[model samples]
Target: MDQWIKTILEEFGAIGVGALMLLENVFPPIPSELVMPWAGYSVSQGKSSFLAIVSAGSAGSFAGAWAWFWFARRIGKERLANWVDAHGAWLTITRDDIERVDHWFNDWGAAAVLLCRMIPGLRTLISVPAGFANMPPEKFSVYTGIGTVAWTALLAAVGLWLGKNYGDLARPLSWVSTAVIACLFSIWVYRLVQQRRTGSPHKVR
Candidate 1:
């Protein structure tokens, strides 16, 4: 992952950061925790601008989230519930569970959307339920942008801080990325096992 991200950032600059964010949302395992910090590191090296990187990341997040939102919108709740009923056990999702989520969305509306964007695994998944519940696109975009920009900024700030003393850690990042990935993977495995055993859909990790 480090090598792939490094190659892209080296080759593509701020655009690469945007692409990485897009990929992270489309493929959740990629993780913004890894990508965003690297972006901040790049900014520290003067390879990219802070505003540019943040904007790119936020845009990528919104685009990916929007795709899922549209998909859920197209599927509609009835169809989704049918799919969830027929196939959700393996996935550990239940019809009632989905409704519970929908009700939550109904009550909280855009605020729930905003809060969920800051969460790690739920960030993208929440968009689906929001869309399933027929959230207004304009309202969704505004809150989504708000939460995404704030979260991405926090990640970039971490990277910038690390960059302040990056000289000694020149060779440490490979292992750092590896360690981060490994931890996330382990957490995912644990959750999958738990989900399968319990026959309930919980968070991915």
Candidate 2:
């Protein structure tokens, strides 16, 4: 990862930042927590502008999300719901849960996309659901851009303030990221069980 990031920074400059952000969305192993802060540190070192970094990151985020959205859109609703019915239990989810989620996603996806983008680990994953729900492309792009840019700004600001200590800052950010993902998964599990036993529609919101 170190060598890969270095390659991106050296080869692509600001564009590389955007490309890596896209990759970060596609591949969870590539963490934005590490990348954005380093971009901030680079700003402190006079290597890049904070605004450029944030814009590039946000653009990359949108592109990556768009890829997922398109993939889900192509997969379509019936097939996905069928897969969920077959495999949801392994993930502690159910088709009924999916129906409720789809209904909610269709109803409130704009806000959902915006809010998830503000979250640490959920931003990219939200796009898949949006696509699965067949959300309007323009609406998805608008909300995604809003949320990704805000998140990029916040992360860049943290990096700018921390500067050289960006390395030090990574530890706690990792913990926070993990905690957030865990919390979300826990909620999904709890909701899955609840809906399964009670036969009710449990909205993600």
lDDT against the true structure, each candidate: 0.83, 0.74
RMSD of each: 3.7, 5.7
Per-residue lDDT for 109 in model 2?
Answer: 56
Query: After TM-score superposition, what is the CA distance of residue 97 in candidate 2 from its true location, in Å?
Result: 8.3
lDDT of 2 by residue, 1-205 (tens): 5445645765666798898899988975566776776677667767788888888988998899899889889997677767766665545555665566567667775898998887765667677779887789999889888888988888888877876655454455445556655765677678667767875332322
Q: How accurate is candidate 2 locally (lDDT)?
A: 0.74
Evaluate model 2: give its TM-score: 0.69
Best candidate according to lDDT: 1
Model 1: pairs clashing at backbone N, Cα or C within 3 Å: 92-201
Pairs clashing within candidate 2: none
For candidate 1, lDDT tens digit of each residue in 1-205?
A: 8878877877898788889899888988788988888888888888888899999999998899998899999998878877877776555556776777788778988899899899987788788888887889999899999999999999988887788776434356668889989998787677568777876553322
156 Cα displacement, candidate 2 (Å):
0.9
Off by over 4 Å in 1: 84-100, 168-170, 195-205
* RMSD over all Cα atoms, model 1: 3.7
lDDT value for model 1: 0.83
